[model samples]
Target: MNEEPRLSAQDMIERLEPALSPMTRIRAVAALLAGLAGAVFVGTLWWSEPGPLPGRTQLAFAVFTVFCLAWAGYGGWLLTRRAALFATDRVIAAWIGLVASLTTTGIVTAVAVRRGTGTGPALAVGGLFVAVALVLTVRAHARRAALLRRVRELTGPEE
Candidate 1:
């Protein structure tokens, strides 16, 4: 039977260096840190509050804290398991982040509007978050395209 040679550890590391870019690492770390901190902060406040609160308010706090925890878990998994994100993976992750941001923004803005207070500020802040996520998503797509182009160039005209 014919056999393909395996890449040595050093060779693998060399190839992986590109996939593990600084920007990718930064994004992963930022997500992990932000999510974790938010979760902890919210949970602490929810636990340490004095006096009774409305049932709905308590539920909201719990739900928000859980959502933050979910984000932290996702970020942790990505940092450890998907540290060396390929071009395709990077694009997918970026899109997921964008969607998550947009969804959160929409929910927050809607809640503020429904409460009949702080609607303007909520909308503005949410819009800014969506804009940032969109920019990141676009950059991820562009980077993936450029990397694919480079790979095709290296692999000759067959592609």
Candidate 2:
């Protein structure tokens, strides 16, 4: 006897939606702004100060920042395309978003620590942002997994 049942579109939406409230989106946006600001601060220091290996370090940092931005943009594109495609598995996209957030957090943390700018506050804020972003990512993954499970349940056993 087949055990899996077929899932409908509505059922899929119900399973996949995390119901991310408006407040959460706002918080994420705020965090992103703060990260951008931190990047600017770091850039100022990197350019203003003269130290050993300054050119190499600054170049490396610039490249890393650009790469991270590109990664973030790519993640956005993937998400948009996935939405247009009505794709059910969002695990990869969600993880991409998560990685972008983590990367931003890392950049901010590095800048704050390297500059010796009394990092307690920056670290705290960045950490909070990272934590929330991670939580959001996990929720998204859970929703995707739930939908896949529901779909498999509806499909039943195959010969």
Candidate 3:
């Protein structure tokens, strides 16, 4: 009986390169679009009437916007790198966590400021955000871990 030769990790990766390349590019483009959308949203907020937002609240919003832009830009940059496909699963998980945390912060800040309420509501909302972030981060980490395990199994033990 004749059998096909087993491929080395490098050979397997080479064979898969064509398929992976497009995925990386798509991720990069998505990141860029998200960043652009976030920037536009911030711009719209600036163009709108200031309403009753205090200077401190405005500053907070500006800081949050900058953080959003930075992370999205980082994601795009990371996905465009030559080693993008080789990035560790942990790195991707961390990026997801950062994005979630930033989004939660922005939403909670906006709600708190818009309502102009006492500390009670703000604290409640902040707690909820923290809980949600924790859940998302955990889920992302678990998923990445599973993917890594499957890849490892396919590729054999790491060098």
Winning model by lDDT:
1
Candidate scoring better on lDDT of 1 and 2: 1
Error of 3 at 81 (Å): 6.0
Model 3 alpha-carbon drift over 4 Å, by segment: 1-11, 17-30, 43-58, 78-116
Which residue pairs in model 3 clash with each other?
A: none
TM-score, predicted candidate 2 vs. hidden true structure: 0.50
TM-score of 1: 0.62
Give model 3 RMSD, 1 decimal: 5.9
Model 3 lDDT, full chain set: 0.65
- Note the Cα lDDT for every prediction shown: 0.73, 0.58, 0.65
- lDDT string, candidate 3, 15-88, tens digits: 65634367566766766677778877876786585577778667756766775576577656656555325445
Which digits, one per residue and each the tens of the lDDT, describe model 2 over residues 41-131? 6667666776665564766577556544544444344433312122332455456556666776666777778888877877788778778
Residues 1-159 of candidate 1 have per-residue lDDT tens digits of 999887654356456664456675677688778889999999999989999987866877877786677667767766765333446556766676677677777778767877888778887888898898899889989998887677666555642
Question: What TM-score against the true fold does each predicted structure earn?
Answer: 0.62, 0.50, 0.56
Q: Report the poorest 10 consecutive residues by lDDT, candidate 2.
A: 80-89
Candidate order, TM-score descending: 1, 3, 2
